[model samples]
Target chain A: MREIFKQEIEQLGLDLVSMAEHMSSAIDKATTALEKADLTLAEQVIDADESIDEIEQRIDEQAVSLLARQQPVATDLRVVVTALRLSATLERMGDLARHVADVARGRYPEVAAAQGRSYDILLDMARQASKVGTQVVELLRTNDLALAASIESDDEVLDRLHEQSFQVVLDEDEDLTRQQIVDVVLLGRYLERFGDHGVSVARRISFLVTGDLTNAVAMVAETSPRNSETS
Target chain B: MREIFKQEIEQLGLDLVSMAEHMSSAIDKATTALEKADLTLAEQVIDADESIDEIEQRIDEQAVSLLARQQPVATDLRVVVTALRLSATLERMGDLARHVADVARGRYPEVAAAQGRSYDILLDMARQASKVGTQVVELLRTNDLALAASIESDDEVLDRLHEQSFQVVLDEDEDLTRQQIVDVVLLGRYLERFGDHGVSVARRISFLVTGDLTNAVAMVAETSPRNSETS
Candidate 1:
């Protein structure tokens, strides 16, 4: 019975990693579409969201089923539950990507002609977010504590870029409406938040392996320049 | 052994519900401080957050210990894992409230004499968010599906209010700085998001009890109104 339950739990973990990968791909496509104002790609990301949503629902169901059937004790229980919570964050990350696509669709003509530098910055942030997502998947797949720790460390880089993007918007004297500037900053923020969620998943993986949340928290604290400075 | 695991898990649930209740109160106090620009109250909320964080960390550690030691299966596993996730959402909710407190502290002098109508709207939103949080706690305590379902329903109202708040900011020709308007709208958004997270906790509880993810997904789909309308 233990062996069977372990297999089932492992399968559920794989499903979650798959969902995370899809979310990362969706964000990548959405970011590219936003930068290029590719209405076609934007629409594709929007339409493809139903699949991501379905995967999320499947992962949730499977996690719950494991809970109902395996009745997994402490550590295994944490893994299943963390999978469920992580799925929600992954789904939201997909939704945020869809929102970015919608924004791109709305401002296609204008964004297509705008200076490429700003879009480039946004793209960089998206890439950073995708990297975090990938690291989360790898951590879950291998149960690699070291990789998870490193992913936690990389979150700070994403934060710095996010802040820099906002500074770019604030310092520019560009002929943009207030709404446009706000939208740009929010877009950066969404990507940054997506990375944060990815880091959260990595932390969960770390906790699952070590039964310790302190290490992940401490790593984040030490690596995060803002938190370090405050301390 | 089953009895011991069950007792510990039940205690964890009660602690989590208690924490969620305290979070609701914290948000209420923070929102009131924001509307009134009451710096002292804001300071209290900020300082009070340390306790919330400590509770959250304690709950997490306890859950992890329960998982590692008990190795509970099915329903037992679900209960413990659900407790951890609920604690996480509650912690983030408290953080959001503290963020509102920070904003209030920053803008107190400028917003002190602002019109009463704006405060009324914001306070109403905050109250609704608090109610949702309370309902989430009630659901956990009683395993009350009906109460959980109602909290799911309330999320729609919160979404509508979120939209209305944004519309008001956009439509008003008030002599407010863009930063001020954004701050107000973001506060409303944060409250709305808090309610949404409460609904999520309710969904997790429903799944834990029924092993059915359908109802939760259906509720989320219904509440997530089409953004195409804005376009």
Candidate 2:
């Protein structure tokens, strides 16, 4: 029974890793689809989000089954429950990626980035967000302490870039239309929040590794900078 | 052992009820503060949020203890885990309420509501959101099927009101300032999401009673309208 539980735990981790991989791909493609105004790519990203949701449902069911069958205690139980929570976060990340795609799809035939600096900054922001997502998968797969620690810093980078994109949009000259300005606002906020959720995933992993939920919340609150006043 | 577990579960329900009550109060005061520009009321809401967080922590520790000590399986296991998830959502509802207060505090001496119609709409949204929050508490306490079924419909009301607030802010006919527009956007989004979390709690209760996760997500999706386009 113990060996069976171990195998189930291993399989759950592998499934989460695969789901995170899909999330990373969605982030990468969504931004590219936004930047290039590639309708097909954006459509593909939007279409792919269903799979992430499906993956979450799978992860959740398996976690519940483990809970029912094994009645895992202490850390083992926390791991199963955390798997449930983590899958929800990952699924939200996928939706955020899809929101990015939706922005791209909503503005097809025209890019959301109105300024050159905005365009450049958004690409960089999305790259950083995408990188952290992939890093989350790595952290989950290997439980590498150093890798999990770095995810927070990566989120900070994405946050900074998000702020820069906003500065670019809000300060745009007359060439940028109001609707386009709205689009940039939407895109930048989406990217910045993507970073926040990345940090949330890392925080969950930290709790899983350390068994300290309270401290994880505090650590994140202290380390992460706020850039509010956006819609 | 069974009766002891049952007693612990009942206590968990009571703690959640108290926490949800706090959340509902926060929502009420927050909207009033925003409309009246009442700094003291807003501060009260903000300061009260920490207690809600504390309640969630206590609930989490107790739930974890139950999971570890009792090793509850099947329905009992689902209930304990669902309590964990439900508390987190309830805490987030508290944060959303705090966010509404933050908006009010930030724009004190000047109402966060820029337009008369927008102000009225926001107040109504807050009332509806607060109503559903308390309704959720009752559902948890009683497992009332009627109350559980009604939350989704209440959320629909919030969605529509949120749409109205958006229309009012976005179509500001030269009367509203940019910052006020941003505040309305933020406030409206916060209220809408509060409603979403309310539905999530109801869904979890439904799942606890029926053990159907997929249908809950689908019910929320089919019933709730989308108002995305914001941060």
If you superpose only chain B onto the true chain B, what TM-score does each candidate give?
0.87, 0.91
Which ranges in model 2 have alpha carbons more than 4 Å from their true place? A116-121, A162-176, A212-214, A217-231, B116-120, B172-174, B212-214, B217-231
> RMSD for each model, in Å, please?
4.2, 2.8
Assess each model's interface with DockQ, reporting 2 decimals per model.
0.25, 0.36
Once fitted onto the true fold, the runs of candidate 1 whose alpha carbons sit more than 4 angstroms away are A1-6, A67-82, A112-121, A141-149, A165-174, A209-212, A216-231, B1-6, B64-78, B112-123, B138-146, B205-213, B219-231
Error of 1 at B105 (Å): 2.4
* lDDT (tens digit, per residue) of candidate 1 on B1-231: 878887887788778877877787788788778767888888888778767777777788798688667766666766777777778778777777776677677676665214434445666777788788668767877989888888877877777776665555555554545555446455665677687677777787887889885866764463334462122
**Residue-level lDDT tens digits of model 1 in A1-231:** 999988888788788878877777778787778778888988888888778788887887788677666666666777777778778777877777777777777777656214445556777877787677667667767888788878877887777776665555545454544455445555665676677677767776776788775755653333212221100
DockQ, cand. 1: 0.25
